[model samples]
Target chain A: MAKEKKVHDRVNWHKEFRLAPGYIILSLWVLFTFVLLGWVVGASFSTSKEIFSGAVFKFETGIHLENYAKAWNTSNVSVFFMNSLVYASISCVLLIVICAPAAYVLSRFTFLGNKLIQNGFVAAMGVPATMIVLPLFGLVAGWNILNVSLANRAVLIFLYVGINVPYTTIFLLTFFSNLSRSFEEAAAIDGCPPMKTFWKIMLPMAQPGIITVTIFNFINVWNEYFMSLIFANSDKVKSVAIGLYGMINSMRYTGDYAGMFAAVVIVFLPTFILYVFLSEKIIAGVTGGGVKG
Target chain B: MFDGAALLHLIGIGKGVTRLKKNKTMIVVFVTPAVVMFSIIFLYPIIRTVLMSFFKIEGVTDAMSKWEFSGLANYIKLFSTELFRISMWNIFRIWFFGGIIVMGLALLFAAILTSGIRFKNAFRAIIYMPNVVSAVALATMWLQYVFSPKFGLFKSIGKALHWEWLEKFQWLDPSHLFIALLVAYCFGMVGYHMLIFASGIERIGTEYYEAATLDGANRIQQFRYITLPLLKGVTKTNITMWSISSAGFFLWSQLFSMVVSNTQTITPVVYMYQNIFGAGNSMTERNAGIGAAVGVLLSICVVLIFIVCDKIFKDNDIEF
Candidate 1:
């Protein structure tokens, strides 16, 4: 027994040693992340000369508030920011409105094509945007709708709603299923109609799930780049992602690195704030569907 | 002519049929919008893309009447193109090599955070911070601030460590560009996967660890015996998610490259983008059909990986 204990102790020591490197790596990564973000924040307030001089943190010549203004106004980040806000908010709302009823029905009622719709959503979730985007581009462009500003935004929103339905529905399906049936039964016993039960009782009952998925959808739409890049490339309706990308591209000639970083910070600020305030929701929304399954 | 009992049964059956019809209408009312949107946007586009790959489409704006049936020529052309071959190789490397690194590190960090670590939430938040930022922003920061030769983080660290080779390294150079992009991408991805792993680890009850400890099992032994087996489902999910994300990799590549068709950073999606939009300088003519072919190929790769993962990591009878 004593010998066995000694062997176990030795095994324990080996395990500790193995984990020591992990702790070190984690610490280094944490340090690297902070330093990099801190540097970016610092650089945003400094002049290009100061940034190039590598004294970004010093702030010797005072902070450049003008960089933010310049990035917002001259660089057209404000336009992009507004576009992103509009797209993200409207799409998120529309996503919930459209997907909630479908998810609720799929979860609650067993009807014809119920299993088929569920399976389709699961399969659709696996299909990447690249698989459909090329043909979608062709379909949209073939309509000659790209040149019209309103049509451009409408098409983009339509694509967003279409693409996100699968995910939002799947995410909500679990939530709706987990909800107890008693409330709906009670409402039905009280002579509440099925539609009314869903609208008034169940929708509000699934508020937490709805809010979580909405937050996720909002973040996704806000950060979306590729589709927006393909469809809404015009200056009138470009998203923050493309706007910052265009700014970065032109900065090569403009040489306004400080203002460019300012644009980066501005574009990053909304989602960063969202993450800071509702991080728990964000994390839950991201991992809930995958982990639960 | 019927008996009284048979007439009563017929009346009951009619009522049941009407109820089912009512239920059907309700279901249709609830499900129609999602179904219609999905069919139009997702199903139609996917089938059209698969069909489009078999045709010769000159431009995205070209009508169906203009599409010439090219059969397997698009696929044949894609396989023959050197750039397409390079892009496939790059995506494969990203999927496999990056998969190992990201999953390994994420699982490790997740384990550490869940193992009675101090400030677990704070650490998890910090790790996940990069994911919240836009990819374009993150990539730009990496290019200008982290990988830049003049005042990059690497340069400062190299100077401090007195590492001459590191100081002289050109991260954006053609030879080093892929590695640079992969590293930056892995950095952003680690946090997202870490959260997934952390959630998985958190789902396991603490009683198991207590029971293992009482049996004199060491931490590593407990992790191996208790954690790994239980996390089979989560690992499968992570692998699938990683493959899907890696397959859609485009923004980072385009951001990292100086030009649209930088061979070093060209990915399958970027190649598809080039073919569809005719944005890159390398393409003589826009072939939307080839782009669709690349899309079809990438989707196949993802589906195959998902299948293989499912087969390998069969969720056996591990009760929660």
Candidate 2:
């Protein structure tokens, strides 16, 4: 019995030792992330000279709160911020409005060309944005629609909605199909129209899936850069991502590294705050799509 | 009585026909917007891109009528170019080597988090936060804050450790630039893949682990005999995802390079962009055909990998 106990102790020790590396790596990564972000936050509040001198952590020079003000007002981060907010929110809502109905019909109803549409979406997921971007740009330019700022914004939103339809529809398809048909049957028995049934009972049943996909769309649209860079090139309509890129490029001439960091923080804040609050939803949205696919 | 009943049945059949017509109309109403938008924006562009790859267009903005039919010339030009070859090699390294590092770390972290570790949620959240931030911001933070030779984190650490050479490491230099970008990109990506792996690991029933423990298996043994085997599907998913994302690597390479055509950090997408936009000196004559060809080649690469993964991971017997 004593020998068995000694062997058990040895096994426990071995297990702990085996897990030590995992713990170490995790802790190191956590520490590095915090330190890096903390440093950025700190530098954003410091003077450029102080930041360059590596005195960011030292509070000898009081925090320069004007970096954010300069970044927001003079550098036009506010415009970009509002632009991003508008684009992200509108695109997300429209994506759901357009995609949910399609997904619902595709999953719940047996219609002509249903399999073909399903296969189309699945095939679209494999095509990269680069493949479509050149032609799309040419088409828009050829149409001369981008000259109007509103039209440009509309095109961007439309592209966002269109590009995301496959993923959103595919993500919600499984959710709609998995729901029991009894509710719909009852609704039909109660003399409810098919449209009304979808709007009232079925949509409510798929609320969780809708919310998850919306969160995913929000994050994706919020961070979208390449398309925005191509389509929304004007100062009046730049998203936060492109605005930040512009700020970084201009910083070379201006040499306001602190202001640049401030702009970076301003751009990163919303997504960071979103992650803090709705991480579970975000994780569910991302991993849900991945695992299902 | 039989004639009256037959008339009533005929009326009932007519009503059913009207209802079916309404249902079909509703389906069209429901699906029309997505289908129309998808065809115009997604499908049309893909078809146009494939068609454009066969023509010699001076610029992306050029009129479609101006395209000169040049079959397979763009592909030959792409293959003949040294920089294009280098870009291809860079992406391959990123897809395979970067993939190995990322998947390994993600699996390890996933296993640890699911092992009843403390602060699992907090650790997961912190690691994944980088992904929430835009790649532009993250790359800037890395280029300026962490990799700067003067006031960088590396410099500070190097000074603290009394290592003079380490403090002056030129991470952004051409010699080391690719590796630097790879490391930074991997840092931001680990959490995303880790979360995917964690979800996969969490789906496994505790009974497997309990049974293995009952048989006196160690943690490593349980991982080897059960977790790894069950994670084949997840691994295949991660590889395919990594391939797709790597093929589309643009922003990081753009951010890392000082010039538009910097060979060290160029990827296929960046090459395509340069050609389409007529950005670089060597690429002054804009050729949408070459750009489209680059895109077609990259798509083929992704599709081929996906097919290979599908074949290799065809086993569905381990349903759990």
Candidate 3:
């Protein structure tokens, strides 16, 4: 009986030893990640004097809420926010409308050069935006495509659609392929035409995939700085991501670290909130979508 | 396009409905938007970019007087340029070395999170927080507090530790620019990629690890035998993204660091940008030909990488 008890104790000790290192490493990683973010938040709140003086951080007598106001007006972020919404939202809508049908056709049909076309799209999806951004810039500028009023915005929408089409289409194609076609056939049997069936039946059923694609596309368009910086040179069309650059760069001369942080928080707030609320859905959609695709 | 054998080949064969007669109108309607967008945005511009490479701007004024065909001159110039070569290396370093760092860290984090840790939600949220933050904002935040040389947190920490090398080195220097970009890029990446990996690790059943553990396998041994093999699909996903993404590194690198004068960090795109829309230093007429050439080269590189990745990964039928 004593020997059996001793063996049981040994097993317990062994389990504890095995689990200890993983727990320690994980705890340290989690702590460091939080601290880094906390440090950013802390620096934003700290006064310039507090930042430069090298003394222990002390809270200001009054919170620097004015910094946010300054960032809003000074950096022209209000315009940026509006423009970003218009650009990202419009692009997301366009990608779904266009890519959904494209994906559906690709999923359902087998035609001449279909595999090649699909492979082409997959290969294109992997193409980096950097590879083509400049050439696209040249093509647009040389043709003077943005010379017309609101043409730049249209061009941007087009570019966004093209950039996102490959990935989202591939993603959605996978989803559509897995979907049972019985519903579509039943709709057809009920006298619904193919286009109508696609619009009403397949699309509604594909809501989860659509939402996932929209979220990815929205984030990509919203936070994209490179293409926006090149194309949307006017303040009227700047995105929050690009607009934030002006505030931070201004710090080189103005040295207002507090305001820069305020700008970061403001720019970060919307997407951050969205993530906090919908992260589970987004993560599930992506993981699930990836597997099916 | 029809074959009885191929139809039977795919899973759920009998469930698939008979194909309707090829409706040209339906095909056109369904395919137009995708086709139009692809042609204008991708194919045309690619061809245009290639054509741009063969011509040189000939003018005393800012406006182009004529396009003088300078066959392969720009390509010759690009090859001869030290900065272009270095920038190519920088691209390779980021995508290659950076790929290993990112994938490794992602796997480690995914493993820990799925290993029955406490506070999974909070830990996942905090780690993935960087994904929600704009790259521009994240870069500014890092520069302001983290990488700031004078009185920056990292600088101060280095000073306190008497790390003399850091005290003397400014990280923004040209030689260190790649490193700086890597650090900035890695933070933004941790969230999304790790989320994908974590979900993947979760999807993998615990039975494999339990079975291994019962066989006297240590934690590391179990991870090696069970986790790594199961995570092959996730790892391949990472590879697909990383390899092709190198073709687009110019966008991130340019935004992260302001280009240094007298030296060009000329990725093909940056070079094209300089040619098409002149920046502060290089205000010249639009060189559409050269831009086209660079675009074609970039398009070719993109295709090449896809082929190379496929060859390397082979046919791992593991999805996701």
Candidate 4:
């Protein structure tokens, strides 16, 4: 009845009993998280009065779909949503474009300052944003370009891409190093140049890593608050996070709780949906991409 | 700048004719853009921030020539400012108190998840879900709903349990605000550290546990002797990461106490922001140098923590 090598399949009551406390602890924590997120989702569809009374589930007057509409139009969440979408999409593509080639070259070839550059990047990851933001803000304010909407949008995306470049490049560098050099060897024998070899052969083989990194980058840029708060000053340039923060503050005076909750839902939905689908890859990549590998 | 860089590239390419030259060209063309971006975004600003800390600049945009050289005055003024001192203490409290809660829960959950549990992926994903969402929204939910006085989760629970005193406590009140912030923040952070610990646990070979079990060693003993010792490296990582994130603590504190900076939640970054960037809450005359000095001091704290961690966790030669 027992396959000694396959310990996962066999279940012992004693072991299960011993693990009862752990199961209780994990399930309770997970349940609380669900209740927290679930109650918000419920409140978003309820009237402000119903939410305050804690009858969000009664559906006394049916679901109020107009909360999303009011939030989207009246609260100007649509603009912030679109701005975030554009910034995240553009930043993701630019990160891949800039990081892929550099990762490939750094991993494939050993040259001067390679180790120094790698060490510098690892160090930069630990550098507090405060350390760098002051001067960057100064330099850009000196340029006096933030007042213009188009320039401000471009600057925001550029900064997003710039801050993320080191992480993305180093992540892809590990992925590139894992790939065999035999493909490049075979390509070189066929009169293919190094750059051509990278684009045609190695790049396609690194699709999984690139997709993981792009998803990671997408979530990061979407959820980014501090940089966008500091850089994107105007409503036209504001991201969803800043937009939601503004709405919550104003809602206090306006007393539109339902609409404010809808805005919160809209702000967090994109990354939550992404996480729902790719939790496996995202969780696995969390440690590898987050700290020093 | 682009024209200058393009001209340099042109001049550099004009001299390459051999195989080595072609390979060099490829490497140069590929890595130059990233290095350039990093230099502008991180390198130049870091250098400037450090240098700016030593001089008294009237405005954020003051030219270098206008920066009056005032050695250590900024630091003196910053430490002397009562608000800055309070902000430093607040951040330290967050790091100390919040670190204990996050690390404890993180380790507990990590151990449970890696204990041959079923549906491990589902549990892990659910726990880590908060980090996937916008932190601003998460804080908003806490401030508006979870801690709302009219009808909050805690209040409702307290009422249902018939605990009058618990229900009467105002979580958002100044007396309880810091604890409330720490609780909400720690809840979101545990998932990240748990994932790190889980990965560290997974890396330990199962054979060791098997060997211990054959010798009649129990789970707790095995954990105390083997798991704890082996997880020293990952524990260091957890602490370092927690410190780094704590150093950049602005979003939550700002969200908690906006418009006017509250003493309970004001972190050094928030203080720096209000001082230099002028979030329009000026408690004192703006000294841009003090803001820069705060940045420098925070960075020094991070570096010091890193060095201390390295010393605490020696490079043991015990081969895995």
Candidate 5:
């Protein structure tokens, strides 16, 4: 009876020790992220008075909808939001379309100078985008584009595509190479042309890749600042990222915390919502990009 | 129900009706938009920048009119300038120490979590959460969270600990500014690199560890023997990218540099901006030559750094 009781107590102890030190670290990471996000959302809702007063959980009186309205008008958030959407959408579409064929050719073809082209792109990736930004500014000024007044949205799109090409090509090359070649071959054997085979067979096979590159490019373009500041000086072309800088810089002394937080929420909400719902797709994209090849 | 013979006949007919056209024109048509955009948007600007860097401009305003062909002068000036020296040193400091610290912490976090810990996915998603938020939003949040002398959490904690540094020094001031910025940069980037490392760790086979455990090896021994060696390729990739990114880390510094107006802690890009778009900072106005000269210098530094890193790592076949 004594031996059996000792064994039972040991089993209980082992059960209690299931969560290891690794689990503690993981828990802390999760807690930190949640707390940071909670702080952002809480600060958004809380009035300046409540924020300073230490009434952390009084959601009823602290909540304010007017702050968003004030920011929307005063910060020109609506205009910037629309501009960002336009720029991001156009840039993403252009990036994928431009990069997809380049990636395909690089991955599939064994033409002369293929190594040279690949090296060029890899070298470009190593070069800082900021390094080139100054020269481009001069070029833009010299060309007298947009009548030398403001940087054009179209030009920004052009710049965005350039910055994105290297990354996109590499990303898609991995996806294309990993995908099976039999379907395209079979399609060609069945009297479909090479182009038709690529579109009907190979393109469909690369859907996950297409989605991943598009999402990443979209986010990158959306969050871009330095390039936007250089190439998008006008009100109509200012993306939300650039606009946020303008607002914060202007209001730094005025202490418009609520308004600024409102702008932050507006900027953060769409992507956050998408990530929350389509997390599986995002995870699949990231892992597939990294691991499959 | 229809007869089996009729169904078979109809399936063959359906296949015949949807036969594809064998046209080579379609390939060109499909490929044209992409090629044009790539050539114009990407290829053109790069070529233009490289070519323009070689030329000399005489007048500030008339960039087109006052250009002379001057070879390598811009590059020569780049090497001579004190500003360039400081910027290069700053870039090295950030890349060497800051990159190592951030990437190291990320790798450690990734390794610990890869033991099939509970809430693994939740932890990963949370860590990556920062990447979703705009950098502007992040900087704003961090500015308040760490820098506000009165209510900033760092200040309060320092005070509670009776730290002289808190009382005597300003974190965002020139003396300690880079340290503060380095901390913020690490916080912002750790999640990204962590995800990369975690995904890499997941790719490592569990059987290696299982065999090690059976052979009288402890957890530490198993990791040291198996995990570190396997993680070499990923480590290289992370290091290369972070190094390149650090070398280019001027944009945000430029934006927030104005926080301390009239200070020259501004990166190369900001310095260029101040020169070109002074906006009444001085009646002695913009110069394209200075801007192009800076660009040429920056590019040289980037290429040199890449070559040096490749030499140091000496492993070109990094899979990740």
Candidate 6:
């Protein structure tokens, strides 16, 4: 806040004039983005006939909420949306549970192979999902779990959690390192076990980092497409991304462009909304941890 | 020995020993689950993919007993296939062409934002907005609306400006599809990289700029000499991320090309899918081995870029 106030001094017209080109470029680019997303939102509320006639802005009759209703109900967007919510929520909880202790250990302990484990996680961040998808698919298909619905969702969630484990651990490890070790020392002096000290005291202290990473994990799992496309073959277990792809392809046949845009809006809304609220934190996370890879 | 042991116990070594043992136990318990998950999810699959790339396996889920040892035959065959070659070329073009555009625009935006621009946060947020949205949906917006020949944003703007060429151009035509895909992709990507560059710039203290200004250095000169050089770490980061994402460029390409794989949009991962999981395999034998080889090739590309970047951007512990 202090720094911002310092930067808000009276503007020089000459300086502003000198930056005219830069301002124009950025404004035009941002204007184009608005037009692009604005047009989609407009089309989603307008009828397909009006959309075809470039009257989405005019809205000849009125705003039609049926497009969203049809997309949410008739198109199985509900199933996909619920499945994604479940998958993302469960996967995020599992990531924190599975990664927090591991990251704590990695940060606090001078154990054998600690550096190797950290390096492995970092490198795995760079390992493309394509490189590892085939054998995982083979193993899952061999187990024949994707054929069953409950087991299918379990498989999807497990994959989501597992693929994110490395990142979650690395990100949390950085958080743990920044914390002062004096908390554990005092706890130990007061008869608290090291593990208990971590759970009781240190974990809550690391909430900011945890929340940031969880937001990232949530967005990642929500937008995850390729693996879901490959593994969740049935509509019963499909994520929003894969489900939306199927709907869009079918909408090509149906020619309900408004409904298609509505589905697109529905599919992207959760993450988009999360982003709207937490853009600062999300941006911080991008530059914070596990991003070096 | 008995006397020494008794003396050590009296000195509290026994209690300390137990504490150390307890700590070890805690360490094992805490670290094992993550290691297990990582090994199952990443290690085993990576090893199997590498080994599978060497064998002639008809099915992706084929048993080990059915795998035929084929040396480098799969690699050779992958290079020989025309579609595979085109896919490789397409990805190369994406990485190369898209890299130039994204990095350039990202740097430009980063510079602009840090240059005391108004509404900086809003511009950054809006630019990065598309990235958080699902790629499938983002690509659909471009394909269905932005590239729509009739009432697309580009056509509307063109018509409003009375520009016949822009109004009539088939932006989604085969000849222009690749460029369209690249443009849409770079738009989403620039925001992330720009934030990275902006953060790097912010980390450099204002002291340096002040010092440079006092020494009669102008904004452009100071930026060229100081800002770019100080951003080596962030540039390495940006490049590594861009390459990694490009290597796994499947979702957007898949959305753009759909089921019918085209030369303009097919990437190695898409080709890998076509070889393994694609439907209607009437003529070509289902060689999951080739798919494995493509996976291995992309992994290699990622690692190579990483090593090259590390060498180029050797860290010297610069302090603000």
lDDT for each residue of candidate 6 in A144-233, tens digit (9 for 90 to 100): 767889999999999999999998999999999888666665576689988898899999999999999999899999999888989996
**Per-residue C-alpha lDDT of model 1 across residues B139-213, encoded as one tens digit per residue:** 888999999888999989999999989888998888898889899999999998888778778888899999999
- Candidate 2 falls in which docking quality class? acceptable
Candidate 2 scores an iRMS of 5.5
Residues A1-293 of candidate 3 have per-residue lDDT tens digits of 99999999998877667767667766776676665666666666666776677532566545566777777787687888888889889999989999999888888876665676677677677655644665576557776756563888887777777887877888898889888766765665577888888888999999888988888888888888667777875767678887877656666688777777777877877777778888877677667776322
| Per-model TM values vs. the true structure | 0.92, 0.92, 0.85, 0.94, 0.84, 0.94
lDDT of 5 by residue, A24-81 (tens): 7667657756656667677777676665554534775847888898888877999899
Once fitted onto the true fold, the runs of candidate 4 whose alpha carbons sit more than 4 angstroms away are: A1-11, B1-21, B259-261, B316-320
Q: Flag clash pairs in model 6.
A: none
Every model's DockQ: 0.42, 0.44, 0.44, 0.49, 0.30, 0.53
Candidate 1: clashing pairs of residues: none
Fnat score for model 6: 0.74
Better of 2 and 5 by DockQ: 2
CA deviation > 4 Å runs, candidate 2: A1-19, B1-22, B62-64, B163-165, B259-261, B317-320
- lDDT by residue for model 4 over B1-320, one digit each (tens)? 35554554455344333434569989999999999999999999999999999999988888999999999999999999898899999999999999999999999999999998778999999999988899998998888888889888889888999999779889898778898899899999999999988888888889999999999999999988888888878888888999999999999999888533368999999989888776555656776788889999999999999899889877532211
Q: Measured with DockQ on alpha carbons, how good is candidate 3? A: 0.44
Q: Give one digit per residue, the lDDT tens place, for model 2 in A36-144.
A: 9999999999999998887998966898999999999999999999999999899998988998999988886666799999889888877888889988899888888
The alpha-carbon deviation from the true structure for residue B274 of candidate 2, after best TM-score superposition, in angstroms, is 1.2
Number of the top DockQ candidate: 6
Worst 10 residues of 6 chain A by lDDT: A5-14
lDDT computed for candidate 6? 0.88
Q: Could you give the interface RMSD of each candidate, to one decimal?
A: 5.8, 5.5, 4.8, 6.5, 6.0, 5.5
Of 2 and 4, the candidate ahead on TM-score is: 4
Candidate 6, residue B313: how far the Cα is off, in Å: 2.1
Task: Give me the TM-scores for chain A across all models, comma-separated.
Answer: 0.91, 0.92, 0.87, 0.95, 0.87, 0.95
> What tens-digit string does per-residue lDDT give for candidate 6 at B232-282?
888888899899999999988988886334689989998888778888453
